[model samples]
Target: MGELVYGLLGRKLGHSWSVPIHTALGCAGYRLIELEPEELPAFLAREDIGGLNVTIPYKMDVMPLCDKIDDRAAAIGSVNTIVRRDGKLLAFNTDADGFCFMARRAGVDFHGGKVLVLGSGGASRTAVACARQLGAREVVVISRSGPDNYENLSRHADADIVVNTTPVGMYPGNGAAPVDLTAFPRCRGVLDVIYNPHRTALLLQAQALGIPCSDGLAMLVAQAKAAEEHFFSRSIPDGETERILSALRHETENIVLIGMPGCGKSTIGAALAALTGREAVDIDAEIERRAGCPIPEIFARGGETEFRALERQATAEAGKRTGCILLTGGGAVKTPENYGALRQNGRIYHLLREVGTLPTDGRPLSQGADLAAMWRERKPLYERFRDTVIDNNGPAEETAQAIWRDFCAYSGD
Candidate 1:
């Protein structure tokens, strides 16, 4: 046999967090394996195969290939984890355990709650099985062409819990909710299996309505932990799941700064990047780079409308990046579309400085503009966009340190 291989198998995995999650769980050999449909059989027949965690498009395809499948996996009709021992492939479904862990961590009580699972894929099956296992009173699967479909969502308006298994709001397609939570007056909790954005549109709406919600990171980590146990035939402490999740969030989440044009966002962003060892991206600067001109020049060329278009493009590109410090132009928040662009991979912090202290050197709108009036007009936007507010009234480094402290301590809750 050649060297044993262990990794995650998927069709497309550019955004997967499984590598880091498994590595944190002590699997040094863990990696991501992107395979086409035809490559599946040949890869599985390899003699050096050790263990693997399967993902979308392959979860059900590998079942018939497995020599034996645990009852749980058999019941769910899906297998996301496989262990190759004695020349036989053993299959198991760890996603069920992961779904349960995610719900419990978010305090989403499935006991007696009617669940509306969104999708008819492998992940949806896992959610349905786990919801039932957690004592869900009734579980309904809503699919595109099913009896209970998106077109007739009002019929399930009394659903107590909404679990999204589809990739509707996944990254690069961010902010597309599968169903409107407001339509479900009785929705007490929301669970989205897309972990990249950290907050799907469904979860955001749930948050707006004061409903409990959780992203899929916990489920991803928990499933990885369960897969690790199966790989090594050993038990891992439950505490390890949260520990790794926290560390991953701290490492991957972006620190975004948004506020008035001259509220020290750039200076504070640089300082925060220095403190946290993350790259600092100024959206205005990026726009200038793309436009090959300065901000004032851009405004001079095509007015506020043109500047905002460039700013929106810059925000979209910058927000797709992970673990960076993003500083936005003051007027960026005025455009409603910029919210999801920056929020896709960031925790926004609004920087506050005295209106009199704000500089207007090359800022077109701020130059001879009514500073106090600007503040009055933009305060609500800042408040609506910020996850936390930091006073830049203090030293830049001190403010940056404060932001670092908060970012580190934030639970992404």
Candidate 2:
């Protein structure tokens, strides 16, 4: 027999991490299928498919195709998973179960507490349902044109809990927040249903305010576990969710490379990108592109202070983008201000290589400069920021491969 084929159905799937979630549950052969509205009908008619998970605009559209939907799915008014049982297509909403799991895991007791829900989309519907199920005192659904929208958000200033189900803080829109958490002084906990950034801007704000906060990663993993139970006809260990979450956390955290001048950060970044299938970005190159000048010219005319200013701006921008292999400049760790932003979304790794073997072609700091003195000056800063050390005394390929293996081990990929 062939392997069981299960997949998530959506229009755009570039940002999905469902495959890893399912695989983490010991289920394999998961696929992601992007279908147009017209393509969905034909695809649904095919019974050969093992299981189909729904997303976005198709969640409601799939109701007619289901033979039956249980009370949980009926109450949520959305179906996220479809499985065949007794020759009938059964639709289920694992999202509801997932939200419950997430709430429990977060130690949030919504009972008799006013809840503020952001957005009025499909995710909002499910979150509202979950909140009500938790016996919330009142549930406020905020939409763009709704009476309780962001414009009139002051109406719910006394809310006890906030749940963001919108895509405002999702990847590519990382720095955006639907509403400021400070508006609700009574807010006890915050949840943003955005898993990509792991630590979203909203969550970060809540954390900064000493409020309990969590990202949608738990809900995602919980929902996948629920779907996996349906797919394989088994219940996964409760501890499995956290195990998977820990892995996903590592996977989403950026693999940041910081090192001395000509320590092969750019080369190692490219190799790591290839080995891990994650995008690699050279911060200095991005800085140069934005400044419209080479590092040498920037130093010659604008001096190191001006160059550091541009570097800081670039680093701040790059820190907001998740899942990238960031190759930072040699002096990236010298400033303490850069550490908080960089650590927000990345795991810093210091690439250490012998000073004699280091090249000095385009780097202004290394040209005619004492390599020993530079390393001596920057070693403490590098040690301060790095989550791990990457020794590149061997071949660049060897160092890259070693980093890749260690990254996977750390991330449980």
Candidate 3:
């Protein structure tokens, strides 16, 4: 039927390895395209492109762009893969199914387990759908914003599995978790969508207390494989799934360092990279590289508003990398766009230290500020955003070792 035209469109194209990986799978006709939101409609009009994969910023937007959405996609309210059937756009969500496949592969039997889910976003919806479909007894959602606010969680809590779909515990810092697991009695398993840090803080803490946990990598690969099936009109062989997953393993689990300025995000990130045998990326450094100037210069030229816009762009670009440690700016969570990207794309960690531990002139934000008051105000926010909290009150080596222990336990590796 002529060469099948398969492609993907998104703003930041740097972190994507879908092209090489998909091509390696023998879908040579597929083409990956990077385009802005404004360019999507025009791109979809092309008869040459048979199907498409949508990522970030556009997963939800593409819903209206489609002629029809599958039931699962309709229920979850998000779409990541689309197929053109008879000149009509057919939308489907592989995320929930992908997560279910991974859970089964990991030997997770949620049939009778009590479940807890963190956050109430797109991923959480998929997780809920999957859990309910699997016959979980109950599923509860926890958020810093309050239970009443997250109606999805309220409807599902008595589940056997606990899933985290929020950005808490992702790299750049370590502190806070989406749900207060302490409140729940016990769960059969903990599932975290944050894969970057390999074993997120939530997973680590759960493991530390002797709970079984799994990261989002398996689900990501499973969904990616499912998407491949849609693009090729055939099932992906089991052997190839293992091969691609193995390649992705080392690439997806890098340390993500986040905290206030001078909290050693960049320095510690480099060291962590060296020790972990993964590449390190400094979001600020990359922004400087792209902006052709230092961060201070960017701020001076465009003000905080402009700098934040640049930060969001940097976060989006960082989200596409297969495996790498990322060090983000102190205020990366201040913007909803950046926060959403972090929630969807990586593990978040918040580096914390007592006011007495500060070096006086080290951090820009620490200047002329009340340590206790600042901590009080920002602690909850950090807790709200992070999957785990690590006390930077100790040596960096000790901190890294603690992080490693948490990862091994959480990932069950």
User: What number of clashing residue pairs does each candidate have, in the order they appear?
Assistant: 0, 0, 42
Cα displacement (Å) at residue 68, model 3: 3.0
* Model 3, span 1-413: residue lDDT tens: 57767866667655455665566677676666788889888877766667777766577888888999988899888888888878888888988867887788767788876666676666777888788788777766566587543544445544466788887765543334666555455456778876655565577567656777777767766777788887668987867766776666534544566666556666667667667776788888888888898877786798778888888888877755545677887777676555444543345678876656655363344567776676676666676667677777777877777665664444224
Candidate 1 lDDT, tens digit per residue, 8-27? Answer: 99999988999989988998
lDDT of 2 by residue, 368-412 (tens): 999999898988888888778989888878998988777766742
Whole-model lDDT, model 1? 0.90
Ranking by lDDT: 1, 2, 3
Lowest lDDT block of 10, candidate 3:
148-157
| TM-score: the better of candidates 2 and 3 | 2
Using all chains and alpha carbons, the TM-scores for the candidates as numbered come to 0.97, 0.76, 0.56
CA lDDT of 139 in candidate 2? Answer: 95
Leading candidate by TM-score = 1
Clashing pairs in 2: none
